[model samples]
Target: MKAMTYRGPYKLRVDSKPDPVIEHPNDAIVRVELAAICGSDLHLYHGMMPDTRIGHTFGHEFVGTVVEIGGSVQSLAVGDRVLVPFNIYCGSCFFCARGLYSNCHNVNPNATAIGGIYGYSHSTGGYDGGQAEFVRVPFADVGPTVIPDDITDEDALLLTDAFSTGYFGAQIADIEEGDTAVVFGAGPVGLAAARSCWLMGAGRVIVVDHLDYRLRKAEDFAYAETVNFGQVGDIVRDLKFLTDGLGADVAIDAVGAEADGHVLQHVTSAKLKLQGGSPVALNWAIDSVRKGGTVSVMGAYGPMFSAVKFGDAMNKGLTLRMNQAPVKRQWSRLFDHIRAGYVKPSDLITHRFPLDEIAEAYHVFSAKLDDIIKPVIVPAS
Candidate 1:
């Protein structure tokens, strides 16, 4: 098998690797069909996450066919098409029982964090990811959702992460049917958040980002009313104006360190040479929300901490909800939307490459080359 491996800071290589097998009775082996590059993958490529072994695969968003399943995996079988959840959760864990699978104790084993994520660091449970020809899916029954024939893999793949994260962001923001929602960042996740907000029946969805291309795409996709931060000097003021002088009912921060509110911490390991987030965008989300509004932070973050204006948040009686998407928890509902054609996330994908060309895919998508938004890697059988 050929897998994308993390080489060094700003480096990646396609290398031959041993094929994976089911290691647990509840596990399954998946032949990856369409694996897409995610913004989170940038963390590993740039060496921002630690504890990722030198040769670990580097992707989490993918759809695949089940090649084999363990005896205990009765819910899934060979030849089943499935969307893999980024979060690995043990079904019997205390958190899983409470529908908080991302915080499953047995799988995550981190006091500070609740979920074990694919292709992340040891702190994230060190699971080998799906950016290769094959991947071993542990706790398969609790993770993957079978995709119906009516939905294409490209449309269903995002149920694994991006769309789910966006839905999670909306959930945390407490976005109600007539509420106005604002999303900071028009990247894939940001756009997804906007789309999800609309799907949730938001009265108005406003997407803010500095990139015109992304904002244009967001508008085309009906994700929201696009706001170009670069063109408008006062982004916060513009958001307020869009919301009729009252801040948005809910504001989601999807721009991590790239925005303003992050404390840049330099951490060194085999992977994740450095990682951080944006305090400015986070503060803007906080400031752009109504007095009784909710703010959801779902973009990727690192060990770096940001100074938060707790006094302001408290004075306004704002609610703050933040976390990586509980991918496992949201998979079912997302698949429902995909199956119903209510959400076609495939429109976000603009580039494709072979497994060996994974590095190039990263370069193109990371640089947003040629207006590329999402790039999917199709490993040859």
Candidate 2:
């Protein structure tokens, strides 16, 4: 089989590799139909993630068909079309029982903490990912959710990660009807976050980003108002203007980095930072929120040590929720949303490339050129 291989920094290639087989009773072999590139994959493309054996297939968001199943896998069977949750988890683990499937202990024993991710890094389970012909899905019964026959693969693909993470971001924010929400960054996850906020009944969805193309898409799909941070001199001030001198009830830093190094002021309430990346977003959130506000971190962060201002957070009485997606908890619900025509996740996909052209797909997506929002790689049928 020809799989996309990561040689090193700024290096990727589609090369022949051995096919995967079911290695555990809870595992299933999925023949990938459509796999999309995510912004987090940029960590691997830039050599930021811990070392994986050469040729690590780096992708997590995908929808596919079950090719084979392990002896114990019963919920899913051959020919069932399903969306694989990006995180691998065992239903029996301590975290799994608590509905914290992303922190499942049994799936990735090698992780420094509790989490099993496909093709993230050696520190993240070291499992081969879906950016290939086939992928081994552990905890198949608990991970993959079946999509209705009427649902297109393109539409269901985003549910694997981006949409799930976005929904989780909104949920953690505890948003209520008529509350205003702001999302920083216009990447796939950010757009998804904005959409989820709209679904949560937010009165105003403000999307912040430098790119006009992405901000435009956010407006089209999420019905979000756009803010060009590059043009706007200050984020907090602009946010205030947008919110009628009051800060947004919920502020999501989906960018994973501080918004231009300007300290966001707590206006009328504590701000929530839904940014994913490193723990640095924590301090940024503390600075941005109004008193007694929430911060939700939906961005990906791995084992890295950093200092946080616990005093500031405690002083403001901030509510902080930071972690990866509990994919299984919302998998069925998200699929139903798709089936009901409530969310058109496939609209987020702007580019498509054949599996053989995956290397170029990475280049275009990582470069963010040509107005690319999300790129999906399809195996030639």
Candidate 3:
């Protein structure tokens, strides 16, 4: 098997590795057909996430065919096509029973902060990801759903993480009808959130980002208004002005540790590792929303301390909701939308590469080159 391995910061390689076998009773070995490189993966690629060991493959969003399954895996069998959510969990756990699968207590013994995530650091339970030709999926009955014949490969793959997380962001925002919602960042999650705001009955949606290409994507793909934070001078003030000086009814932070607006924050967090995460976008989200409005955070951040505006949020009576999205929880509504042709997850995909070119795919995505919003790895199993 050939897998993408991390050597150091800004470095990745495709190397031959031993094939994984079923290690748990409910485990299934899946031959990865379509795997996506998430923004969260970039945290590992740039050495942002701690304990991301060398040679650990980094990918979470994937759809594949089950080549083998353990005896306890009764929900699926060999030859079933499935989309595995990023979360690895036991369905009967305390949190899982409440539809909080992302915080399942039974998985990730090292997790006091988060649950098991495929291809993340030791902090999130170090499970090998689906970036390679094959991956081992534990708790097979709970983690993956059969991909319907109507769901295209790209749609199934996106639903595995990025798209689902974005929908989760919008779901928790609690947008009222005709409310103005503002989204920070124009990445896949941001774009999905912006689009979903409309579906959730938001009267207007605004996507904030510095990149012209991504802003263009937000306008075209999400059909939302765009604002280049770089040119706005004071982005928070501009957002208020756009919403008639009262501020937006809701604001979402989709940019996490690697936000680019503030040089000092970016250098301290993303470069120097002085802070767990840069709170530039989150702080901006707090300031851009109206007092007593909602602020939903879908961005991936480190477990360490971040200088967020907690005092201000309290003073303004803002509702701050954030968590690693319970991906499977959002699937039912999303599937209906997909079937109704209201949402197309496949549209997010922009580039595809073979397992042999995994390193180059990482470089292109990390560098934000070639207008690559979403890149999928097609590992030949």
The models' CA-based lDDT, in order, is 0.79, 0.77, 0.87
Ranking by lDDT: 3, 1, 2
- The residue ranges of model 1 lying beyond 4 angstroms of the native Cα positions read 259-275
Report, for all candidates in order, the number of backbone clashes. 17, 7, 0
Which candidate's lDDT is highest? 3
The TM-score ranking, best first, is 3, 1, 2
lDDT of 1 by residue, 248-305 (tens): 9999988776411122321110122222643666788889998988989987766546
Query: Could you tell me every candidate's TM-score relative to the true structure?
Result: 0.92, 0.90, 0.96
In candidate 3 the C-alpha lDDT for residue 303 amounts to: 49
Best by TM-score: 3
Tally clashing residue pairs in candidate 3: 0
Of the pair 2 and 3, which is ahead by lDDT? 3
Off by over 4 Å in 3: 259-276, 303-306
